[model samples]
Target: MGKSQKKRQMRRHNPVRVPDSHLPKGLEAASSSSSRKEAILPILQKMESVDPAERKWACVAVSNLIQNDPSTRRLLQGKNAVGALINRLSDSEEEVVVEAAGSLRNLCIDGGFDICAEMYNKNILTPLKSFIPKISTTLSEYLENPKTAPENAQKLVYEFADNVITILWCLSETSNKAMNAINQISLVPFLMSFLASRERLPISTVTSAAQCLYVLTDENPPAIEEVRSNAPYSACVLSIVQSREGLPQANGKNKEVADNRGLALQVLCCGILRNVSPIPPPSVAATVDVDRDIVMPTLEPVLSLISLVEASQHAQEHIAKEDAIPALEKLSLKHTPKSDHKTPSGLELERLEHKLRTVQLALEILTGVCATLPEPDFDVQDADGEATDADGDEAHEDEDMDDEPEVDMAPDNEAAVKQQSGSNATIFQTLVAPLLTLIQPTPLSFPPLNGPSPHPPTTSALSAIHVSALECLNNIFLSFRGAKIDAPRADPDSGRRIWDSVWQALGAVGTDIDNPGQERRRATWEIGVGVLWGVAEAHVKVLMQLCDAATDEGVKVKCIGTLECLAQHPGSVDANRVCTYFSQRVPEPLLQAVSALIDIYSDETLPYDTNFRQGRFLDALVGSVEGVRKAVRGIDRKKERELRVRGEEVRDNLVAFIEYRRSLGV
Candidate 1:
């Protein structure tokens, strides 16, 4: 045969399987080889062809060719392939629609990700979802077709749903729009029917249903009734809670099923809990429930979820570990309203009690576990082998004492400054991008909240999951904790005041220092300290409060005892930096702190019954002034002069406050 004729014949007879690798070795010989479309077009056309049997192989070929590119999938942006797939959903051949629907799934890959920016405005998915019923009806038609094989037709519908999920998982804004699509197109009813059935059920239907619900709830507020996005979430949670039997897939039938049902419940509980907060969160317009409508009856679900997490505890979790301390660190912060009324229903109250017990129990467990972990040896070996060489001249403790090493002043090294640039990755994956996903409370305008987002849209729904993650990070940092505590540009006055406020909270009367579990103030103190340190400044007021607590006749001695301990922390040391910037802030806040302390003395004891500790704190503060004055000579002379004056004023104010408290008859 002529060379050209042989090539043409090869192309016609076996367009697709003709491996390009088999092209003649010479460049010129390959120059005339078939183009990409020339090879695949025939296969694609046949796959979409009306011919019954050829379409099967055609679908197979299409899947293979498009495996490497987005262009092939982009070709079906509208319903170009839908019409044929819908028709083929009823194809007399099982392999036909199976291949067709599977090939169609390739269309979802506009890019590597599940969502696409292009699909948003294109709005093609709306139509696709709209038309599914037509295809489903076609399946129904085939089921009853006397002339056709009904079993193959049934399989076709199921295949179509599966493919649809794969496709949706690849679409743009898949969660938001697909949710509306699921509801509008009646996928919910269909899924519920399957779940309700006793037969060998397709779990794909359930997973897809769950994904849709997750997406819906994630992007939009849930509907108010059982049909809302939360219905699926709640149902999924309930499913795990009630019927957590292992599925066929969990036993290795399918790769998608593992024991995420409990986790799924956890996710659902978070989403639900996030809907409300101690503080009102921002608004989210897309939710079915308005922010105001989103209410927590009490912390009951928080309690229940904690129990659930405990019930289905993973053997490797910190709580389950023998030595780990059970944590009370359920991230309990949420936006609270000004009013302090309890939720009307006992439901929320019960929940709070339950959660309280769960947290308390969890803390005990975690603490127990922590005690088991090996501690770093506390033995501090003598440096320079001084003990080993007893005759060696003792290294002068004063050596280079006058010349302190230069502190790193770079922004990154300073804890206070680092806050500006550090990446605060949260326990919640959602937190990395939009506030709606943040574990923190959504701002009033975030998600442009209405009333408030169904949940606070706040810190990724206070799940034990995220709390554990953050705590793990905390423990890690605490283990090898670096970074200098000293920092420039930190507002020492503000820091000092915050510190003093914290101290007052901790030292206040009726304070249950022994029972941290019940101490709301203690919880806040932990959070405040975490935050203050996290932000890299000491709370000034807390220091002053601590000092003032030392003033109480009863608590003065212990307060003095803790003065050294308080100084061990950032404490009023920050007042130095405040003097560096604003000369007045340090004294102003201290005066306030001293005054507050005097007020506490008027009561039975200091805030935390640390009244007897006050005298020691006052003595330390009085004694430290000269050393501080000496420390300030060259450091900040101009600011120090002002502070000295302010100190005198503060002392006078302290005396006045003392008289005022005495008059109050403490």
Candidate 2:
């Protein structure tokens, strides 16, 4: 056969087809070798199709292309896909609008500053603002006549709102310009109106609106002030939080959904409240009365959650049956022939996570409120008519040393004390009680010091709860100390209970204060300082016990640092009432601990690379000893002499250790 005839026969068997009309207009002839931009340009062209269905398909395709592929995202941006999507947001068809919004939302993901800036420059907000009136009108129509509304309109409305709010959230997170533009459009009021409306919106709608408000108000003071100034807005959020508070705890098919909805509302409300209630300095006069009207009511539901969980756990433990274990094993064996073990279902785990998040939000709100309330004043006066410190200042002062800085231990005036005390008591009852309960650790078996820790470090809801609650307690204690009030006196047995719980949490976490690991150690040390700084002098003995029980060098160092903080702020304790307590009670144990630590530093048999031999540790030890010396100096001559001698000994040991390190050039 001729060569040309043979080629023609081969082509007939396997023909090469050119681009056709079946594919998108510009995309039909594109080959596998086409660049991403080449592939996307045709899709972008198709987005302008006159048919709403075609436009929706085009937008959906664009969204999928950019979802996680950064290269395609860049290609889409180069082809002006964002501008095209923005234009499509106003399409007559609801489906087209939803897809376009989803596409825009995808483009904004991980786009960071550059993409947000691009969107901002392209004026994305204009189209976003236009959706507001349209959504509101459509929602109004749907709510008015649900049965007559367009089929699937309810779902579309929620998707549209969710997408719009998510876009705004992403943009606000990335660009200051976008945030400012959102603020200028009065977005807070617009979003708050949805939340505040009498019409019953979908849970998703309410959640989206709340989330938008949260993102808008985060570190944006004007927006926060806007929400705070709007009384109806604040009331609406409170109502949502309070309304869900009464939701009955039930187990059913849809129970998880209900719990999630409740959690979303609660978290958003807490965020709003936290943003509005700025923590003022202790000296600033309290402007907002958060206790009776807002805080106590807000806390009632949170406390109820705690009680519910405790009750549920208790009931689970006490289920009565003669052969409960064997019956359960037999049933399990029958139900699962292949495996005898069971794990929490996805829904069950999600529900648990939601519960923990709810508790965390509640604790965060309580912390914010406690920060704004005035400190309680617990100082009482003597018969001499002079305003006295909580402890008798005169009895503790030594006349020989005439140059000591005069400590102002007199509490706030009478009326202020009475007013603050009531509010403080309310806070104690509402906030402190639940927090104390949440942070209380269940007993866990731990390995020995030389062995690996049984509980490996992880980020869980319980861990978050512990960290947040400790932070709240720290703030509460600081507030009390600043007000010259004694926490123990205000709530009789509560102080001891709180102290014990804090100690337990500290022990459970097993923080190595010298070589802290992960977030847990940081949180543990924060609680440690809080304990020493807030707990009264009468409980110094308990503080000392923590120091003695600590095995980790880091923990021991933190314990010493806590003592130094107390000594640095001697006026925190009642000098006159606790004069003997400090001079007689505390100095001996404190000195002993210091001496033992100093001996550890001085030990020649220990490895030179040990943390004890480190300069930072020695420096901290010296500072602690010095703090003790200064703390006792004014209380009594005998105690002052004893502390000074011990301080010198500790200093000498630290000096020797430093010299030893220098000799080795370490």
**Model 2 lDDT per residue over 420-444, tens place:** 7666656666667667766654321
Residue pairs that clash (backbone atoms under 3 angstroms), model 2: 392-576, 513-554, 513-555, 514-554
Best by TM-score: 2
Predictions in order: lDDT: 0.34, 0.54
Q: Please give each candidate's TM-score.
A: 0.34, 0.53
How many residue-pair clashes does candidate 1 contain? 79
Q: For each candidate, C-alpha RMSD in Å?
A: 26.3, 18.6
Output the lDDT of residue 358, model 2: 61
